[model samples]
Target: MDSVNSLLEGFGTAMSPLNLLWAAVGVLLGTAIGVLPGIGPAMAVALLLPVTYGLDPTGAFIMFAGIYYGGMFGGSTTSILLNTPGESAAVVAAIEGNPMARSGRGSQALAAAAIGHFTGGVVGTIALVALAPAVAALAVDIGAPDYFVIMLLAFIAVTSVLGSSRVRGFASLLIGLTIGLVGLDQMTGQQRLTFGSLQLSDGIDVVIVAVGLFAIGEALWVAAHLRRSSQKAIPVGRPWLGRGELRRSWKPWLRGPAIGFPFGAIPAGGAEIPTFLSYVTEKRLSKHPDEFGKGAIEGVAGPESAASASAAGTVGTMLTLGLPTTATAAVMLAAFQQYGIQPGPLLFERETELVWGLIASLFIGMVLLLVLNLPLAPVWAKLLRIPRPYLYAGILFFAAVGAYAIGGEAIDLVVLLVIGLIGLVMRRYGLPVLPAVIGVILGPSAELQLRRALQLSDGSLTGLVNTPFSITVYALIALILCWPLVRKLPLPARWRQRAGTSAR
Candidate 1:
């Protein structure tokens, strides 16, 4: 009942005229940017981080919520029309959505995706409202050692689960930790990696790191692999659904959130797995399985809904546990830190209005997303026709401007370029970017907890595993690290084949 009351109050805050306007602006910008190839929600948020610098925290966060959901819908537009997924989560959409377009069912595909996104997002947000306070309540009992181990688990999970090569992922994480170590030591007040430079003592701003890696780095990479010819998008009309089409899509839309939300809440549980699982499940359950691979509406509906739901799940975990499950969540975590706010068990107590208001705005964003996407999809499709050089040039310009605005220091630009180059290198080598961003954001907190735990135990290593929670988390981490080796052990031929197939 208290949760219901708080949520109702949150609606009041979100419905204010100024906050509502920010939500509208975010939806517009997120969709516009998300329609372009290679731009995902994380990159969209990073590029536009500067725009919210002057706004109050509540308004900024409300806008971010809008951008986040709008990006999901816009990415589907590109996938359906151009067969180009803006991000990995949208890949499944291209598989069936593009074919639907080619078959003159593009409008139906768009309608199903838009409505499915609305369904998943709404369900997931409702789940978040119910789950986050409970999770945060449970988290209040955790000790420093337990907190440290949980972060350790996050580090291992991202490195091991994201990329094809654990080596590359860990390598990226190391780079991020190194960057994170650039500031003055919190305990001893000694600079570890500043090299006697005054500016370095303050640490690299996460804004610069985010914009550099996602925006500048991506722009440079696209420029390097510039394709001279642009692919034309398949023409689409206003998205609408018929009665029969809605019946076919409603089940998948419901099932998609069921699959996606839990994964989103878990460490290293990204939209990729849930979306794929939703696709496979829909294929097995569809009465018109024959229509699959040839442009089935269920294919467009299921995965897109899963992707949106997973995004909401990611936000829940971040708010309740201070753990980021995806790149976009990591950047949003940085946004929280930028406002001098920390997310954890204490967040609800300290910033009740902000947390509840943000949740309420998500509901608003969903409705706004459906309304905008249903009518303006054809307009978004036109973004694909933009010339590559012009689009990239604009990205680079914003990257520089956002970076420079951080402290108005000329040196920041140099740091931004250097970080951007490193980002370029990471992308070229198949290194996943999520682990690095996580390392940078969580590295300091992890270190602080480690030192506190050590101090409490008189410097004994056993202090780290003294608690039941810490022990369990360490055991889980051990299992994750050793699974690859366990998989290689001698086993029945059939079991080995099954393992191999699951691994792929």
Candidate 2:
């Protein structure tokens, strides 16, 4: 009954004409930006942060939610049509989606992708509505120490699961923490890391880092690998899948969300694992198993749906836990902090309307993007064919503009350029940049929380292990952090021999 009333209240807020209109505009803009390569939802929101300065918070938030859903919708398009995934979540979709396109049923592949996106997106929204309340209800008892513990758990899990090399991941995280510490000390009337530069005194802007690392870095990477090879424009057949195709795709759609939502709710490593799992499941369950790799529709459908579902699942964690498993989620969390809206267990109680409205808008936005994309995907693909030089140069220009706008200092632009170069170098050497970004975002907060936790427990390591739940949580963190090392234990000759012998 209480859930019903909360939902009713949510509908009242979501149904407002002003909110509805903003939601529509946000979906459109998100789709438009998502269609462009290297300009995903994180980049879109970060770039638009300055513009939200004058708008009402509710309206701006609704728009931000639309952009989030819209980017997921738009990401599948590039993966299937151009074989260029706009987001990491879209990477799995590109595996089979691109192959299906090359199989001369590009239209069928695209329709499957669109329908799958819609199906999974709707399911994701439902899951959000169903789960967020329960989570929030339980969170009502949580205090500052609980939040601190939760944040510590999140930081450990995120860094541990991000890269193959834990050392590298921690290194990246420390770099981010260092950057995050650049601003003036909050408790003191002094500065910590500002080397007397005026812009440094204000600390580096999150928007600058987001845009430069994601948008600018990607542009530079593409420019370095720009190919002049002619891509024979593949004809897109009828965009609508037949009833038979839809029937076959339904299971994958359902199964995908089941796989995806949980993944998004976990650490960054969690999402990638499921894509491989989904592919394996689809391959085994496919009625037309022979058609896999030869354009089996399930191959394209399952991963596409799962990836989007995973993307949606991150929202619950971000909103209720104030933790982000993915780089994009981290950026969104930063955006929320920028607006002075700290999302966590207390968020729903304090800002129920905003939370529910945002969830409701996702449902609306998914439908809107489906309608907009179904008949007009070909138009969206034109964004991919833009000359690389032009696209990259424009990105550099925007990075400069966004940097200057945020800090109004010439030094911010210089720092942005330097970071972009650092990003380029990191990408070149295969160092994951997301950890550094996450570290920068969470490092100081994590430190403060740790200090508080120590203080609360009277500095006894044993005192910190008071609760069974938290004790288990720490054990879990240790296992995850040491997983790479644990898996390398040397007593498994049978396992190693079996794998090597099987390969022979």
Listed per candidate, the RMSD to the true structure in angstroms reads: 3.5, 4.4
Worst 10-residue stretch by lDDT in candidate 2?
495-504
Candidate 1 structure quality by residue, lDDT tens digits, 298-380: 98899889988998998999998889898988888899988889888888889999999999999999999999889888988
Candidate 1 TM-score versus the reference: 0.95
With candidate 2 superimposed using the best TM-score fit, by how many Å does residue 345's alpha carbon deviate from the native? 0.6
The worst-scoring run of ten residues by lDDT in candidate 1 lies at: 490-499
Predicted candidate 2 versus true structure: per-residue lDDT over 379-418, tens digit per residue: 8777667776777787778777877887577877888887
Q: For every model shown, what is its TM-score relative to the native structure?
A: 0.95, 0.90
- Which one wins on TM-score? 1
**In order, what lDDT does every prediction score?**
0.87, 0.74
Q: Tell me, by lDDT, which candidate is best.
A: 1
Candidate 2 deviant stretches above 4 angstroms? 230-233, 269-271, 486-504
Task: Name the lDDT value of residue 188 in candidate 1.
Answer: 91
